[model samples]
Target: MESIARQSVKMCPFMQRAGSVQGLQVLHNANLPAVARKCPVVGHAMSRAYATASGTGARRATAPEPKAGSANEMVANHATQESLFDYDGLFETEIEKKRLDKSYRFFNNINRLAKEFPKAHRDLEDDKVTVWCSNDYLALSKNQQVIDVMKKTLDKYGAGAGGTRNIAGHNRHALKLEAEVAALHKKEGALVFSSCYVANDAVLSLLGQKIKDLVIFSDELNHASMIVGIKHANTTKHIFRHNDYDQLEEMLQMYPRSTPKLIAFESVYSMSGSVADIDRICTLAEKYGALTFLDEVHAVGLYGPHGAGVAEHCDFEAHRLAGIKSLPDKSVMDRVDMITGTLGKSFGTVGGYVAASQRLIDWFRSYAPGFIFTTSLPPSVMAGAAEAIRYQRSHLELRQLQQLHTGYVKQGMKELGIPVIPNPSHIVPVLVGNPDLTKQASDLLMKNHKIYVQAINFPTVARGTERLRITPTPDHTDDLSDILLDAVDDVFNELQLPRVRDWESQGGILGVGESDFVEQSNLWTEEQLSLSNNQLNPNVSDPVLGNLEVSSGIKV
Candidate 1:
């Protein structure tokens, strides 16, 4: 509570001997610095900084703090007190909003029976349903050999990987599995992670963080994992329209060629069955001096001569003709700097990987906390996944059959006046524009028809684009197709869902029932489909495919 006047009066030794007015006049007459005049101890030179009369740049030395628990301190403590925020209530309100909007998800207990292939039991062992929305595109999960390999390795290596790779988890199985993944994408090296979700998140994050001023150009409709990784990277980002290369090019042009950039996209967009032009995107990346990050999670075991993915499939004939050499010429897959894929989907195991140049792979292996801190996949899974990749690579028949099944479902849906958002890949997306109806339709399919097709709602796909994303494997045969088609027809009729005609009448959306919608030819051409496994090149080696004895003999 000491004033400047009182401080000066108290500070001056002369003021103690002389009267207050006479002592003040003596100090003023001495012409000391304002700070010195205020207190003899402070020797601040700038009068403006030490000025007692306040104006701009006028500052006062801080007063000493009161002792703890002093009566004067009570007021200061009261000023800092703040009420607690209702954090749990905030979560409750957000969840309630999702519930009210019908975007809330309710999971079904559908346990897929390995023996049954495509048909799964729900809750009870006997309570079965036809699975229409699983991502096991080639049905390799049902292969007895793959299962046997997993079982044998499981018996040998135990249930879990001991720890992360840097600890006890690094072993021959991990190396072999990584080799298979690298060979699948024809990359110099590959690094495995707990899941592809983690792989995308880690790789994209590392690129943006390590490379200074790295700008990421992501597809607007990219998977949530990529988007999350981009956000975590905390760098400049431009989201181009989904599959709109022109907008992407324009944005790329705005940046100098020397500027570090990355174009992150997916090979096959899971929601709409849409396929990206991998070659074209690669070309743009090359032109703009941008690194390409392709997520082939959905397309890996469903495309290319060796089931490498859409990038490899872009030059199918060249790869297929390469035979023993693997790479006769540079390919779109080769040009792509990084490719991420899952062992869980087509490979029928559970993990993810990034196949890239040796330096990049090594960099991630050393730096990515997502990979470093997490437990490694069990040996059985690694073995099984490697087997699946080798199995699919040798069997071109599986991809063909999957394409055939997808075609059948799409054809049936079109013929039945069902609103199918068309694309060239092996996905059958039956668009239901309303969230409530999408949920209702998904529930009804499982309840009445015993068909399980999970509803796609907002956040996964955009609003008003809710759909039932159907995935057809090689095992979904003509008989099963007939059943699925008939059940779907009945469900549509009962639900009174909009048909193709209805969508067209409403001016169409997402390529569904649009009057000017261009019909996309299937990714697999007629000639390609006609050629079978018997026509495959004889010189190709199958290093990763073997029984237990040959486990360590993998050459890939």
Candidate 2:
């Protein structure tokens, strides 16, 4: 009898739950005769009388053949308001708001020529412009060796990464890339993702979702990726003001030392160029029994002895003396629980990664959907990324020259009374204080000077704090710097934009034009900057496997 009852239920084709299952309803609705609706079973199915687990009769406005239409049908009938919701109108209204606020993002058609480094063409091949705002910190994007490896890998493996890492996508390139990343940060293991944004989102969200009562302390200035991860984490979160260790400690004090907590911050806040006190933050994390999740996206491949970023840069001398291994106990890099970075920037490739202890990385690899389900980066990209990292590891001159170039631009800006928001790092953010003018300055530079520096505006930064963000590549010589400086000065004068003294008179905003704006010493000190690539530890050139093979599930 029980077996018969089970079979009856399986065979019965009544409305399963609600109208949202439109395909099922459509299947039966098309087959059932009108008289079939008179039958009790058919009637119930047509009316969707079956109870849903949620005990709600409400259905999606986009589903069902009865009244609610299917997603495709609604989109097809979007010109009419027959559907319950005006889906198209909602999207249009949101976009219109962006346009009104002067925040509508316009995608410029700038094609960067790899061989020419910062030189790129606008629209036409002949319309050339110097890209002054690229995040390619080390200019490794144009490195011949990196390109050669990528081209070779493309020839051998073809384009796509077959599939996700667990599938055919897993290959030697993935292995070597992860290995290089792990070694770069002196971590035991690493996991590559589609992008660092995905990496940060996956790691933080997975941590919060998995750990019960997990609390995340995030810096206000942390990237949107981290912010999204924390939001999806769906747990308690305390947002500390940017780099406010004291506030972070106070928040941590609320939770017991044994409570699971994660502090997410960046080594260098990209917009402001502010440097974090990694050692101090590490100390606080230890005292509070919290794990540190440092986003080194902007810092990696531009800092430290071997391009490991600010955390490694924190213990610069120590990392420089020995290879990744043999660091002093709990060195800054060692102290960070997880270090998430991008290969797209200084590594000159298109992928992101997180490096950490073997166990933590394994857990992230096994659980984080971003890594587990997302398609692996292409073999050529992985190969190019690995080679970029490896090449940069032994070459300290790139980072040194990058810093030197940044200093040159900053000095020239100062001499011209340009309002450069000062920082210790290589980024040069010139405050325009108005979004309209910031855009104007960017357009003018590209039009008149053939310099492509993108304007930074809200919601990237707060309103009234718009600026022109410039990044100086190692190859942007003093001659180019002078041209850029001259053009910027001329633009500000033409537009009547506020100069440093202008803002100083108006009472300084965000360190600009402030009488007390403290000048920060560059991240690389004069003594450190004086040293050449020859001084970098020889072991950096040696492939220190660390935990790459032991922990990698890819099984290369």
The prediction achieving the highest lDDT against the true structure is: 2
Candidate 2 at residue 38, lDDT? 41
Residue pairs of candidate 1 with colliding backbone atoms: none
Give per-model TM-scores: 0.84, 0.85
On residues 436-522, what C-alpha lDDT tens digit does candidate 2 reach at each position? 888898899988999999988899999999999999988899999999999999999999998888898998988887887787788
Each candidate: RMSD to true structure?
Answer: 9.3, 9.1
Task: Give the residue spans of candidate 1 off by over 4 A.
Answer: 1-83, 539-541, 544-556
lDDT of 1 by residue, 1-556 (tens): 2244457678666445555664455345443332242443354433334364444564545445555435553333222222457999999999999999889999999899898978899878899999999998888888898999999999988999999866874777787887788777877778888999999999899888999999999999899999999998999999999999999999999999999999999999998888998899999999989999999999998988778898988888888887435576688888999999999999888899999887777778778888889999999999999889878887998999999988998889889999899899998999898999999999998888899999999989889989999998999998899898998889889989999989988899998878888977888998888887767676545864222211222244
Q: Stretches of candidate 2 above 4 Å error? A: 1-84, 542-547, 554-556
Supply the TM-score for candidate 1. 0.84
